[model samples]
Target: MVRVDRGLATTIGGAGVARVGYSGRILEAAADDPASGPCVGDWALVARWTDDRSTLEHLLPRRSCVTRAQSGGTSHAQALAANVTLAAVVVGLDQTPAITKIERLVALAWESGAQPLVLLTKADLAADAAEIAADVLTSAPGAEVMCCSCVDATGLSEVRDRLGDGTMALLGSSGAGKSSLVNALVGADVLATKEIRADGRGRHTSVRRELVVLPGGGCMIDTPGLRGVGLSGGEGIAATFADVDALAAQCRFNDCSHESEPGCAVLAAVEEGTLAVRRLESWRKLQREAAWVARRTDARLRAAELRVWKQRTKGSRGHPKRR
Candidate 1:
């Protein structure tokens, strides 16, 4: 099976296009367009073209995909990257990291079938970097947490060492220093970086997602900073809040809501101070979002099916009887 390193989408005369990187050369290819356009880190099969124009035959199966609910009122999910092995949830140390946002992103990463790594960037700016890292570790239960400063290159080696010969993706909000971290890992000024504003928000320097080869023998996809991350249906919620799920398993009722219910082990844990109330609330909020997305997706699927059925039966209903 022939495969390329990076499948980054670029624009051609206002038309969305995809490029395949192979043997240190970039090739423009035609891709079988889907409802959602090709994303970074996608694996695709390319057809050899005699003419200058190349065609993307089809997209190969994705091992994993990082997706989020489309921002606007649309009930659609957007794919950030495809076939990612590691998802680095970058958070800036200059500001107090939002644990809830981290949890949400971790859930999305888990749902993508990739290993989630909580990365604390700009560690040099924060006086209590270690303390903040510890708090983030609590929010991310089963994932590895690391702190690094791009300015001094502290902990960059460790982060590079962890990404061993697989596609990794950088995910974070604006001003989380994702671009800086990418530049540090690649050891060059390949991506642009911007200064954080007085409001502590970083400018959106990366407008599109693109893949770059790491110096140490791996590829990484850098995505634009996310302002609002909504959840789609997946096992990420259960994985992010594994502690709460474990407690829920011990509940007397299999369908226990964990709210004012009899023999509710989850509530009991919260009452006994084992599980943090804030964590429980976050889990509940994500669960609700996931459920809503699932309903909307199902409705959309049903509507599509109905349209297909109507198209198939359209002219037949009005036809005259045949002998």
Candidate 2:
């Protein structure tokens, strides 16, 4: 990227930048700041660059955004990426793939207005990669699940068949060989990767969530390993866990938590083995986390909205607005 205006100028990168143009950050633009650098592959307002003017003027609007609940404070959804057309949930087959975790991430991706794909890597390590792939299909409906190993051309071919010429995000816990997969596909080890004990976990390699391009032609954004992804609480949550949510809707009380609730269809499904108990439990846990995030986000949003209204009210009443 060519340096321009300290941080307010424009960047001209090949391919990736050309495909997805620049837009400034939302929170920064909300505060009316001109220069906070463009938010990469995210929703932003874009303005024309004129000879007389140095800053952007109009917001192009975001196609979609991925977010998580505030980590520690009451804050609205933090935007992960904007205009993401596809999201690939990376799962390692070396160990039992947490279907729930995959679901939660998919939920976030769906919430962001992006279609989700499931990529199960490390077929060489998993006892039965094909079987696990089948299980993944059952766990997440309407998703493309691929079991692949970068060890050979066949596996690479399988993976290449899925990714299209669009922006796709790679999300999974570290050691899933996301970096390796990216390298193999690109026909080089351009991205850095490490190998630890296959059986053991706990080596923080990727720290920040940044976007990188796969060598071929498509682009991918690699994110830091997330221990948990909290949903922002909305239609996406219901859509991702439609099975559980549908059953919950059938309960006698709309406020049913599915725990000792009368006429709880969700619990009944668990009993009948129609829904895996573990899956139900996972859904419940995510619901709880989503609810928490919603509450915090609502609180944050309400505060900001109220402050805006308060300022207008004070200005109308001939009183100086409170700082």
Taking the candidates one at a time, how many backbone clashes does each contain?
1, 4
The TM-score obtained by model 2 is: 0.79
lDDT of 2 by residue, 106-127 (tens): 7877787788888888888877
For candidate 1, the lDDT comes to 0.79
What does each candidate score in C-alpha RMSD?
Answer: 6.0, 4.7
Q: Which candidate is the best by lDDT?
A: 1
Give the range of the ten consecutive residues with the poorest summed lDDT in model 2: 13-22
lDDT against the true structure, each candidate: 0.79, 0.67
Checking candidate 2 for backbone clashes, the offending pairs are 42-82, 45-59, 46-60, 47-57
Q: What is the TM-score of candidate 1?
A: 0.87
Clashing pairs in 1: 30-56
The prediction achieving the highest TM-score against the true structure is 1
TM-score of each: 0.87, 0.79
lDDT of 2: 0.67
